[model samples]
Target chain A: MRFTSAQRLDDGVLEREFTLGEIPGTLWTPESAAPVPLILMAHNNGLPKADPRLVARARYIAARGYAVATIDAAGCGDRPPSAAAEQARADLRRAMRAGEPLDEIFESLVGPLVEGAVPEWRTTLDALLELPGIGGPVGYSGGWTALGIRLAVVEPRIAAAGFFAGGYVPRAQREEARQVTVPLLFLLQWDDEGNPRQRALDLFDAFGSKEKTLHANLGGHTGTPSFELEDGCRFLDRHLK
Target chain B: MRFTSAQRLDDGVLEREFTLGEIPGTLWTPESAAPVPLILMAHNNGLPKADPRLVARARYIAARGYAVATIDAAGCGDRPPSAAAEQARADLRRAMRAGEPLDEIFESLVGPLVEGAVPEWRTTLDALLELPGIGGPVGYSGGWTALGIRLAVVEPRIAAAGFFAGGYVPRAQREEARQVTVPLLFLLQWDDEGNPRQRALDLFDAFGSKEKTLHANLGGHTGTPSFELEDGCRFLDRHLK
Candidate 1:
């Protein structure tokens, strides 16, 4: 991992960018040199790693003595979205619009990307945890629900996680959620259009975590209530810090 | 798995259409009272389970004392092609015309379907293998190569397998091919349009099968040479039965 530069963006948030092979990502941490809990953050499909939503969350988390790391998912940020990725998205959208079962489309685009991303996340985690002033348990906080669930499910290194309601969980990967045993906080947007209420609830029900929480709010997918994030942070603080 | 009916289709070839829940599939066995090696077959994108190419292959294999079976890939054949599958095809065609990488589009549609199909294949295999005369050391011979590679990698039950060159292998899933160790025969069309020559050779090189053979012929993806099929049959006869 080669970190290119570090700049204090906010009063307490220090933004640093780095690379691991072709993967480019940014990290935000408190300016202080004290050891702190680390949270890996991700945004929704329409946003980049530095999307305002994730940046705000990273800032909030970092301000309270936590280190947050995020990397652009393949073709998401600072990288040209491959024509292949674009084509996959178009197919997914067309299929969804046509009312066909979107499981195959979702996985076709996601499975390999997830396969590629999982190792990257683990590698990033390994490199970041080695940095000075970062220590102890780690957690994941992200808006793209399945990426968070999928990551948490496959990589047991995460202590606790909070995933905002977004994408669908393909039937093929649904059983993977049962493999997740860490503390989980699911932020469900009751009126999320991209994901149905039942789907979110069903996924939440499938989690193997004995210590899991679902924070349902009236907003749509993009409108995650602030208090819920706080509650999620408190959950992370309890488990990670 | 329930066997609804078995009908003698063409002299030596007997067709049995069965269902497992909503899944529809077919089996072709030689009209005989003896046990034989079985080959589970899958056709490429241009064909269905009963596509002339696959049906012909099944008939030839069955005539040679091999029971061949195939099912509608989820959202294919008897079932309506999901919008996702259709969209993926369209995207692939457009990308091929535009000289863009088709792997993501292929994977986006195929990956999830493959994931869903794997367990179904296992279930179908379990059910078929239990029937009176159809016995052990099952083999998989299929087009749309990744599904076969993915299956052969994960499911050790397959005794010996052959996969026709079809789709591109993503880097993430490429390593999984290294897990395949059964006696393998890859039938390659030298001038395949959907699958380029180098990709086929590369994937063949990645296979962990120490007993693997690559039978290459001069033709496009659509025009498979006849002599190569006979050679492939001999290969299957040597290892499968």
Candidate 2:
């Protein structure tokens, strides 16, 4: 991994843009002398690493004394788009406009995205932990929650996860959720128009972790309450610190 | 209201046993010069104010600078038993043992209990708020959640509530939940043996509070994680302080 640009925000959080192979990424570190626990923050629903909400959350978490990082997922911003993913997106749009069932459409769109993204994340984790100011026993945050579930199951370095639960989770990932034993803090918008509430509740119930918590608040898809940000940090603090 | 006894605990909390007319009660207050916001802590179901878990929670919240109070429901603790309530309890036990439906039995048992308790609680609040070091804008905590719903609806002094959602809520109370507009922090134990999971989720959905939050953890009825105690204080702290 090579950092291409660096700047310090007003709050003393150091933000740096970087690249690993062809994947673009960003990292935020608190102004601390000692190395801090790393949080691998994936953007919601394959959103870019630079999405405003994701950046805000990254900086907020960094100011709270954790090193946060995010990378552009496969077919996301600043990355070459896949033809098949484009076709799947078009198909999804057509299906929605036609008022068709979404199970297969969602699976096709999200399945490859999760599969492609998890490995890049693991690679980034490998590089981030090797850096001087980033350390072990990481926590995973943000969504696409399918990727979070897969990473939590496969990545032994991730000690806990905080998942945003409004994305379309594939059937395979829902099944994999049963294998994830890491402590989880899952946030769901109670009235998310884009996501069915029962599906989110069922996925939460499927999680195999003995220490999973679901914090559901009243809101639409993008309307998670701000206090949950502090709660997320506290959740990681219990596990990582 | 008449104070029967008072003592200072090891942590500097003042525990006072009191009685209002025929009802027995307890109040815990933090060591502070100024008035603190009150939390009317109802014991789970109709358990007495002196129940061990109730005392522990009351002292914990009191030490955090809130005055917490609880009272015995109509037929609980040291109060005289009502023959009707005893018959309902017997019917409930017989229904559970015989694998029979319990809707009517539960309504008979809890409906009168809630009706009787809510008024007593409101009277206690009236008396407690009149005393020095106990101020207005109260928050309600604990269960016999049916009683909580009724109180949150009828008692305008209540600003927020944290309901422990493991008790058998009467069907009438589930309907009353929609009228409760106070901000709520509802806690559900995911694996609570005695409470149906779907019922708890449905009740949470039915709440009309725009600022409501549901915190579900992996445990049975009495196994809410210790960290939730701190979280509960923070919830009340946000609204009350």
Measured against the true two-chain complex, the DockQ scores of the candidates, in the order shown, are 0.01, 0.94
Q: Which stretches of candidate 2 lie over 4 Å from their true place?
A: none
Measured with C-alpha atoms, the lDDT of residue A175 in candidate 1 is 73
Q: List the residue pairs that clash in candidate 2.
A: none
- Model 1: how many Å of interface RMSD? 26.8
Summarize candidate 2's per-residue lDDT along B1-241 as a digit string, tens digits: 9999999999999999999998899999999998999999887655777788889989999999999999988878889887888788888889988978878889889888888888899899999999898876799999668889999999999999999974479888898899999999999899887678899989998999999999999989888999899899999999999
True contacts kept of each: 0.00, 1.00
Give stretches of model 1 more than 4 Å off: A1-241
Total residue pair clashes for candidate 1: 3
- The CAPRI quality class of candidate 2 comes to high
Each prediction's Cα RMSD?
Answer: 22.4, 1.5
- Expressed as tens digits, the lDDT of each residue in B105-185 for candidate 1 is 877866777777788888888888898779867888888677787778777778888888744755545668888899887
Best by DockQ: 2
